[model samples]
Every structure is written in C-alpha cells, then in structure tokens.
Target: MTDSDIGYLTPVIDEDGAPFWQYAARGQLRIQACASCDELRFPPRPCCPRCRSFDSTWRRMSGRGRIWSYVLPHPPLLPGYAEQAPYNAVVVELADAPRIRLVGNVVAAADAPLDSVDPELLSVGAPVRVAFTAASGGVTVPRWLLER
Candidate 1:
C-alpha cells in the first residue's frame, strides 16, 4: 500500500489536551505547566501532578530535543501502520524540560512519508527538532527531524 492509501490517526482531543493540539496546529509546541509549582507536564492533565493544583497554564516549548529511545516496528502492529513498516517511533526528551518526553515519528521533512528516514541513522541521544505535518481531517501532528 502507498502512503496515500494509509491514513494518519488523529489524537483524541480532550479538555486537558485540546490546547496542545491547538498549539500544534499553529506550529507551536505547548505543554501544560503547573501554575503553582511551575512544573511542566506532558500528556496534559487537569491537575498538576507535582503540587496537586487544579490551576495550570500552557507554556510554549523550545521544540528542541534528543532521541531518548526508538523502535522500528517490523510487523507493524496496527492496520494503517503496516504500510509504513521500518519507520522509527521515537521517544524524545525535551531540551528545556528534560523530564518531559513525547512520543512521535522521525521523518526527513515536515510532510515526508513515515518511512523517509533510514532506520540505521537513528540513534539514542541524537539531536532532533520538531516539525508539524497537517494530516487528513484537519489535524496537525508534531514530528521530529534529525538535526544536522
């Protein structure tokens, strides 16, 4: 199957994560920060995990990070993902917030196919920068690209 034949999955936008997707659509990466403790958190929650405060705010991120870990799914676990076998799924540790890690794919360009990056080139601790891709259904996804 071709890349066009396989559709990208849209993230489930809830009250806590709605701002994240909204910021991504605008080409800015924002994560939840605790208003009370000034702690940054990912996979946004209504309450701060650090201080248990219900008050939180959105903070723009540097979008610079390093690959903490990665995997090449050989037998693609999902239906659409099977078409993009050998693609790298990476866990990136943010430069400014080392404790905040995000999971995404590393591609050659913003809109490049999932398999654009060679799996051999990916390594733990490799520097990467964020890039956004507008997928089907008007959803924008944050992807990573190797930093030269």
Candidate 2:
C-alpha cells in the first residue's frame, strides 16, 4: 500500500521545532544546541535544559547511532497506526552526542513500511543509520536502518 493509504501521522511543526523538520526535508539531521554551553538538546525546546540558555543553534549530526531502547506497539492502537501494528518504535542515541536520543521507526529502506524489519532482529545497542521518508504535509521524517 502507498504511504497515504496507511494514513501515517504527520508531525505538528511549531516555532521551536520547525528548523528540525526543515533540515530533515533537506536530508540533514540537526538538533538544537545551546549557544552558550554548546550542549545539544532534543524535542526542540526554546531554552537549553542544561544551562537554561534561550539562545540556541541548529547543529548538523552524523546520522549514526545505536539503539538505546525500543517498543513494539500492540493492540488498541491509535487511529492511523492500527494497520502498522507490531511495528517497533526505537530510541536511538546519537554516536557523536550520546545524551541526545531520537525516537523513530526502523525500516529496511526510506520508503519501507513501519513493520518492514523483523521484530526479532531489533536489539538494544544495535548500530543503526538514518534514513529519511517524506510524509504527508510536505514533511520529511528521519527513520533508522540497521547498519550491516
């Protein structure tokens, strides 16, 4: 089935997180970095959590990471996610910035379905690399692929 047929949820981009989506559209992975302390932050907050600095910059990442954790969603799924049940949602810790982790799905390729990868293959600390998929509403999301 096509992506639209699966009815994937699109991210709600706000002022603080707009840059993150924009970078993803350009096939780049960036995180909010505190201008003062140079600490990277996730979820795109306005101020730095470490130093409480409002001034921040978008820093490009290496797009390489290791799986920190994961979950396989069961029944009672959300409206658009039921068809993709048994899919794995992973938390990946960036190789360059261990403290910064990103949540995403692990697929075989950029356009693969959420449940493309065998669930039995997923493991914590498994090396992964980034892949981008263009979702609805002109947004590009970063997904993960198992590194061979």
Candidate 3:
C-alpha cells in the first residue's frame, strides 16, 4: 500500500474502531451500530450510548452523504498539511444516518491532493460520495468526492 501524498494525519485505530478501518481498506464505509438498540454511531465505542449494551456490529453505509458544512483553512493547523492549505475539510451527514457525520477532506478523486478541488466549488448541502486512500502505516483513510 502507498501513502497518500497529502500527508494528512492518520487515524488512531483502537479496538472499538478497527472494523471501520478494515472496511474502509476495501472501499466500504461502515459505521458502528448497537446490536441491541439498532442505533448507529461513529467514533466507535465498546458500549452503546443508547442501550448501554456491549454487543456491537458494523453496518455498511451507502457511501452517500451531503456536505453538511465545510471550511477552507487558510493556514492548516497541522504542519504536515501546510502545503495543502486552502483545502476543504467537510462534515458529511450520511444519507442513511443523518445524525452520523464524518469529517474528511473533499478531493477531486481518490488519492488526489487535499486541495484538488476548487474551494469555490464547495457549498453546504452539496452531494458527495466516500473515497478511500491509503495513508501512512498501512491504514486507509476516507476522503470525499463531490458528486457532479
């Protein structure tokens, strides 16, 4: 696997979140769900916040979402992303789970630089689809592509 050129920070995978990353490696967007309550959640945890159950499962999302909000950072806070300044970081609300939002960069294509898309092109409620890119340490990170 090759690391993305943007050098974006890698996600810290924990026991509860491993499955999500595993699915992403295969280009699937899976979210953690409470087996008991049937509620979906992100930033996976061992216990369901709603039902307080230890049983959990992963649900594959449609990979479809809307850009709930976005920002083009003038000077990226992270040093590694400095070269990719003016790139967009978007919060996408899943079409299947509106309350489950994911934060990621919107690029022109999978593996494209963070700033690949023009900042002026982004807007709230813009349609987007999930794209995965290999990042440092054999981890795949999710990015977004504007659905045009």
Candidate 4:
C-alpha cells in the first residue's frame, strides 16, 4: 500500500497544544516551558505544576533525543495501519529536557513510510532526532530518525 493509503490518524489539536503543532509545521521542535520556574513541560497545559503559575512560553529544543523504549506491533491496532505493521513506535526522551518524553514513529526519513526502518535496529537509548510531516487538516506530526 502507498503512504497515502496508510491513513495515519491526525492529531486532535486543542488550545493548550496549538503552538506545538504550529512549530512542528515549521519544522521546529518546541516544548512548553513555565515562565515562572523555567521548567519544561510536555503535553502542554495552561498551569505550571512546579510553580502553580499559568504563565508559559514555547522553547525550541535541539530536536535531539534518545529512544527510551520501543515496540513493533503485530495485527496493527487500526485497520488502516495494517499494511504498515511492524513499524517502530518509540518513546523518546528529549536530550535537553530529560523529564519530558514523547511518543512517535521512527522512520528512515522525514516523510518516509512508518515501516521504512527495520524493526531490528530499534533499541533503548539509541540516539535519534526529530522530524516533521504535514498531516490532514494542516496539522504536522513529529517523527523520529536515527542519528548517524
């Protein structure tokens, strides 16, 4: 099946996470940070857990990370992704922000197919970098690439 036919689900953008998608569209990896305590946060929310402040700003990251963990699914959870079964779904721990982690697929290139990389190459603590791809509805999703 073609990449278009793989039908990856588009993210559900909300007020709290809008800026993230915006930055991703521009090929930048940004995380929400607390203006009060200087703490970085993921799954961006309005309030800062450390300072109990509602103030926050977007911080650009190095776009560098390491695979904290990964899995290759069989009999894909969604029928639309079945053709891409065995793709690597990875949990990446950001290099700059150790406390934050993000889940995404690891592909050979920015816009490559989900299963483009061999599953055997995946491992915990492997270095990776962030990549982005435009999705349906003007949203951009982050993908990962192994650091050479």
TM-score, per-candidate, Cα-based? 0.92, 0.90, 0.92, 0.93
Pairs that collide in candidate 2 are none
* Candidate whose lDDT is highest: 2
| Residue 126, candidate 2: alpha-carbon lDDT | 99
lDDT of 4 at 70: 91
Could you tell me the lDDT of residue 12 within candidate 4? 79
Candidate 1 matches the true fold with a TM-score of 0.92
Evaluation by TM-score, superior candidate among 1 and 4? 4
Tens digits of per-residue lDDT for model 1, 15-45: 8998999999999999899999999998899
lDDT of 4 at 116: 97
**Candidate 3 overall lDDT versus native:** 0.89
Best by TM-score: 4
Range of the 10 consecutive residues with the lowest summed lDDT in candidate 2: 1-10
Off by over 4 Å in 4: 1-6
**Superposition TM-score, candidate 4 onto the true structure:** 0.93
Query: Is 2 or 3 the stronger prediction by TM-score?
Result: 3
| lDDT per residue as tens, model 3, 17-125 | 8999999999999999999999898889999999899999899899999999998887776766788787888999999999999999999999998879999999999
Where does model 2 exceed 4 Å of error? 1-6
